[model samples]
Target: MTVILKKVPESEKYILRNFCSLYLHELSNFTMNLDVGEDGIFHYVELDNFWTVDGLSPYFIQLGGDIIGFILLLERPFLNKSNDYGINDFFILNKYKGKGLAFQAVEKLFKEKQGQYFVIQVAENRRAIAFWKKVYNRLNIETHERQDIIDDELCLIQTFKI
Candidate 1:
């Protein structure tokens, strides 16, 4: 029942790459339309940037001792904002869903990183949208939402200041 967000180190970047491929595969069900390349792996082009970039934090969602998924956090402003942070990616394995672990993990993160932040979910991903809605409601925080085009696809962005 112990959910933790373990910060990933540079030497463990490969772990993020491997898990992100699976995360993307799971996301393919929700309008991601991802495809594996000739190498037979779903490559995340920005995996390297998480380490090299100044304002990015990558984490592995762990339950006790086992790694279940990951969350990628980005700092600096986005979506035309001057000072904001963002949840770049979040995923929990199917087996881990509906157990309230996601809420605990994110709540713990919000407690540690307090600032203006936004999270974007693909417009077609009702599951993601629902999850974020529940998160905000449970956190009891006010949020601003809008529909916007990102990477040429319609997305729902939720902005909040904690």
Candidate 2:
């Protein structure tokens, strides 16, 4: 299958909304709680209410003209000691897993963009940590240090030098 990556558009917002809603629903069911955090500090994220139009410049990973995943990125901060370009909320549909498509997509991102580093934060839980490690290892990405924790969940920060 051919995967095409493109910037997000108005027409595709509904598709993104639907996909995230379903993903979060599944996550909630797996966690047995809608709140993704404990100790009264929950991550108040409504899938429908997510995705800021201004804060994020979104991109969709489309295979055979079908959107299978998305990635969000932020501009690199000027004062940071290390190279770090923010990446958030990357997800691929379950049907497309294990195809190496995500690796290809990220490789393309580094190839096309002039950025020096690609930074992403993943929850330090089982599935997410495993997935991120696998992807980064497959893509030969590495990190210098771990980032902060969010809502009691260890947030793993990885950076890929481009």
Candidate 3:
């Protein structure tokens, strides 16, 4: 089954904001980089930039009209600049894991915007590192992995050309 990537409309901006809070919460387990505001919500300061900034895209990952996750695509990522495209954020709900949807979604995005692409993970996120490795293997794409400090935190960066 092909998972669809739908461009998020401005009208549905709130939906993306809500989902990003959840995504950030999950990432907190690994990076400890995010926290809830006094308002009792996790606020993503960059979420609004997708609508106003150049070289950014927001998409909802769908399975037959059901929105299961979201991905934020970048033309020139803030964290890494060498690659032509970067994944600022990507998430598939826990229930959707181990079912190949993530692989399918990444495959579709990478193919649609074929070029030098990169993905970054918090250095301690071993699960994320393994997941990306499998994705690369399944796609059979050559990759380069290295370590760098981004935002003052150590991160694992992987780059590839499609």
Best by lDDT: 3
Tens digits of per-residue lDDT for model 3, 49-133: 9989888899999998988899999885443556788887899988998899988899899878988888999988787889999
- Candidate 3 Cα outliers beyond 4 Å, as residue runs: 76-81
> What lDDT does each candidate get?
0.86, 0.63, 0.88
Most TM-score-accurate candidate? 3
Tell me model 2's lDDT, rounded to 2 decimals: 0.63
Candidate 1 residues lying further than 4 Å off, grouped into runs, are 77-81
Please estimate how well model 1 matches the true structure, expressed as its whole-model Cα lDDT: 0.86
Provide the clashing-pair count of each candidate structure: 0, 0, 0
As a whole number from 0 to 100, the lDDT of residue 136 in candidate 2 is 68
- List the candidate numbers ranked by TM-score, top first: 3, 1, 2
Candidates in order, TM-scores: namely 0.93, 0.72, 0.93
lDDT of 3: 0.88
Residue 34 in candidate 1 has what lDDT?
Answer: 78
Model 1 quality (TM-score): 0.93
Query: lDDT by residue for model 1 over 96-138, one digit each (tens)?
Result: 9999999988999899888888999989889989999999999
